[model samples]
Target: MAHIRERSLTHPVPELRGHGLLLRPWDAGSDAEVAEWLRGVSDPGFQQWNTPLNPVTDLAGARGSLRARAENAANGLSASFRVTDASSGRTLGHIGVNEIDRTFRVARVGYWTLPEARGRRVATRALVLAAHWALTGLGLHRLELGHALGHDASCHIAEQCGFRAEGTLRGAMFEAGRLDAFRDVHLHGRLATDPAVDLK
Candidate 1:
């Protein structure tokens, strides 16, 4: 047996193009940009599901938090990227791979699309690319995709991307505000080694 160094990797820092959608990592000093996007955006659907970043003390606080996680890839933590438009570079949403396990070859998939980005099948395309990257570039074995029990669009996106339902985890997550207790979430998952017979 030998100890192997986990390969240091960088997420796609490109203007990813898929089905007319683009995704890229956040840029330096994007705090105001990200924050302003959140300003006055009233969508309970987004808030209930994704916990829209709020109570932002200042631009510095927001940037420091997001950037610190990106800088922590040397560890097993997670990092997120901005889902945006290729031509105009407008922010559409967010996506990330969390619960990274190098030794175990596993990670959790998570994403949220802006209300404007929904109904366009944009998530399906972005997630397809994410799956391709996760299974091939990241060398992951299994990926978990979870969502609040009532979140249908999220579940649909996961299933459309080939992730299979794995039953709900009772009291799995904590809701925001008022110190809410664990809430049930529907669990879905997929494995990299799932049969490739269809590949031509």
Candidate 2:
């Protein structure tokens, strides 16, 4: 697998601008931002939608998470970005493309927003920017977005970002519930050939 640093040494991760948001590489020096991200992930709402996951309990865990993200990006396995407020530069959320299959020109996208960022279409805009880059900048042919069944907000975001509903995978994911049971997943995808929808 080609590392993102190798690709970035040639073609760096582009700055993606959106309405009221800016998607950029995660900053390694921003302890406050990292802490905020940990808080967001710790939110019950966020945990509910994105679960069966380890929680970042403290500064050390947060640093470990950021380090892992950087290493993944450096190795080309994934590209992660921090979604920030355009004006104040407050960290609002995160979005990333993972499971990148260079041979197949495909990847899976995921995101999470802080409680204060909810209902603002922050994730939707970030998704558009990331997907656009994946399709054009990365020259990927296909992109996939999946969410646990019943997560209507995620489904709406995927649809608004031009991904078409594909199908459902039964017991495809696990959520951090009482028993950590597997849950059905709703899949959506977009092809590079798909017409771009006006997000304005």
Candidate 3:
């Protein structure tokens, strides 16, 4: 596979703005950001779909998580963004292009919307913004999105973002709360050559 010669991300991550939203890097020093991060990770809906390797249950954990994301961005391994309302500047969700493989020019994507933002297509809009940046701005060849099987909402979002359903990954992810248990994942992919998705 042909890969982009430049693999590392820029030191200062650029903000993605469009679709009435802004996708910016998480700030670890902001108390409000930390608080929202705590609420987002601790949300029941988020927990139902994602089992983060470094779980965040409190303020300290939330700070650590945000710092880790910063480190990853600096090292060019990932680009994580806080999805916020452009006009109000209120955080609505999280989206990230994770586990980036520079050699292959590919990465995995993940996202979650807070309870208050669930009904407004927050996740979908965020994914669309992130996907465009990952493919074009970041010069990645492909971006993959995987959700635990039966996650219909995520499936819909992936489809709307132009990530084609690729295949099923068996025993691919840790079950909701159990690291020892595994579950199937529905994998989706969007290549740089694929047609762009229309934003609603």
- In model 3, which regions exceed 4 Å deviation? 1-10
Candidate 2 local lDDT, 63-141, one digit each (tens): 7788788788777788888998879988889999988889999999999998988998999988888888888878999
Provide the TM-score for each candidate, comma-separated: 0.78, 0.90, 0.94
Q: Taking the tens digit of each residue's C-alpha lDDT, what string does model 1 give over 71-153?
A: 65435465455776656877777677777787898889787677777787666666766666667667889989989898888
What lDDT score is found at residue 127 in candidate 1? 70
- Give the per-residue lDDT of model 3 (tens digit) for 53-74: 8789899999999999999989
lDDT of each: 0.65, 0.82, 0.89
- Span of ten consecutive residues with least summed lDDT in model 2: 1-10
Pull out the clashing pairs in model 3. none
Per-model clash counts, in order, read 0, 2, 0
Whole-model lDDT, model 3: 0.89
- Better by lDDT, candidate 2 or 1: 2
lDDT of 1 at 116: 79
Candidate 2: count of backbone clashes, pairs at least 3 residues apart or interchain: 2
Candidate numbers, best TM-score first, in rank order: 3, 2, 1
In candidate 1, the residue pairs with backbone N, CA or C atoms under 3 Å apart (3 or more residues apart, or in different chains) clash, namely: none
